[model samples]
Target: MVCMKDPTVQTICEIYEKLSKLDNLSPSKNVDTLFTQLVNTCIPPYPIDVTKLCTQIQIIRTKLIRLCGHAEGLLEKHYSTILGSFDTPLDHLYIFPYYSNYLKLARLEFDLLTQHCQNPTRFAFIGSGPLPLTSIVLASNHLTSATFHNYDIDGSANSMATKLVQSDTDLSNRMVFHTNDIMNVPGSVLKDYDVVFLAALVGMEIEEKMNVVEHLAENMAPGAILMLRSAHGARAFLYPVVEPRDLRGFEVLSVYHPTDEVINSVVIARKCPIPTVSSIDHQGFVTQMTCSKCAEIQVFNHQIEELAMEEHIC
Candidate 1:
């Protein structure tokens, strides 16, 4: 078994220690055993000290991301195993979902984005790992007019995702895959995309993120939406989530937290009439939006579904 020492780290810390040493980066009986334990431990956003739990989650996730690189493409390999075992992708999808339950976890985010963006026809999914569940959902759901483009840095993943799409002939036609590092992806390609999805687990550092933001700020067509998956509470432990500050180039339209679901949050942003020094006028402007009734923009509010009603911004 893999071994590491951490007095305060607890379960995930121990799991990380074991996982880091997986024989040749392949999942063995030990890996499956540990995965079972992990699923039970992390699911069910329990009513406990979430801050501590989330921190542990993030640490384990970050470590997995780092270790996956050396594991001979083993990170997403296990997911393939799981998918193959399923009778139909949708059979246990809502339950088992992706390895990290990313789609199920981010269900709230997707639901919220769909509600607000209504008829987005052009979509780009960045860092769509081997599974490409997000792209699959978008294509399958919006077959009428939506076009989904997927970009990934991993050549193997890009290839696998392409095949997965082709496996569903209908989906294949609507979705296009590209193997390109997010930092290297051309701004012109994303120029007309109505919506761009930046996965939370996207393996990118601060510098790369900055490069992407700057590129998008310069390239994405005006009025395009950037759907950023953000981590919150314990879900933040899963991946490097986005912060409002990271998206200075775009305007924050809304943030939605799917209650009783994943700990991650979603932020809907719009690139339009790029914020200028003048946008921040005297009465302490409300970042991207303005008060419809009065000048005082006191606080940020929840999304409509979350609050069961629309908020009056005044």
Candidate 2:
């Protein structure tokens, strides 16, 4: 839907096209330069109403996501290959370009999870890519005892990820990878996890994203934590935006938008114990089955909404 005549749209399209066709996806001078320009264009230095072009940008979001996935896979594969040769590969995690970002993100998620569940026994990560750095970092630094179940649709990515962590004796026992679509994962299996982390790139389209959310809502244990990655501001062009309303069976606890290099915003929610009421009473009161979990979520959601507005991050 983008107008080819518009200079900004044209530039973005051109850059995306070139980037998609590139044979070498590894970190290189040319790849970095193109990605830099693309980022600058998508997120300008000065605010200029990027939302107006959101519809147009969304038309090509699937392609952009695919390109990003492929690029990330290549980068991870490269790193995995290099690290596979080392005896203490986990110790050399600093060599990764986005190692710092992963560390910060994992820490943030850990803090958020701890707020609701003090001592989580197990967690599931959907769409954990080839490197699975977030899971690695969280297991290594934060929750040392918690079992990690990583799910990825791509068998090759799962294979690569297994290779990366298989050498680490600590992680080898705790980290488990499943090569299957999250949709196919049974509810019985889902209810076992104390917390679930949905990766940013899991669902490329809004419908797909919502379907996954709905599925999790139906399956995940009541009061279990669900942490998902979304995007805000201009970053929505790169990743799907998960509004609070889209989470029907979950009570949103907090939404954190990072303005720095960490692209995906984090949304933490807890599954409702029972079905939530969809309508308001004549007195304009939200009618719901009252419970301890509902009471806590209502208080936290109100505070989070106010904070989001003041921070302009929701």
Best of the candidates, lDDT: 2
Predicted candidate 2 versus true structure: per-residue lDDT over 138-159, tens digit per residue: 9999899989999999898888
Candidate 2 ranges with C-alpha deviation above 4 Å: 1-11, 21-27, 40-55, 276-314
TM-scores for all candidates: the values are: 0.69, 0.81
Minimal lDDT window, size 10, model 1: 290-299
Whole-model Cα lDDT per candidate? 0.59, 0.78
RMSD of 2: 6.4
Tell me the tens digit of each residue's lDDT in model 1 across 110-177. 55566557788888888887777767765654335688888887787877666555555567688888
lDDT of 2: 0.78
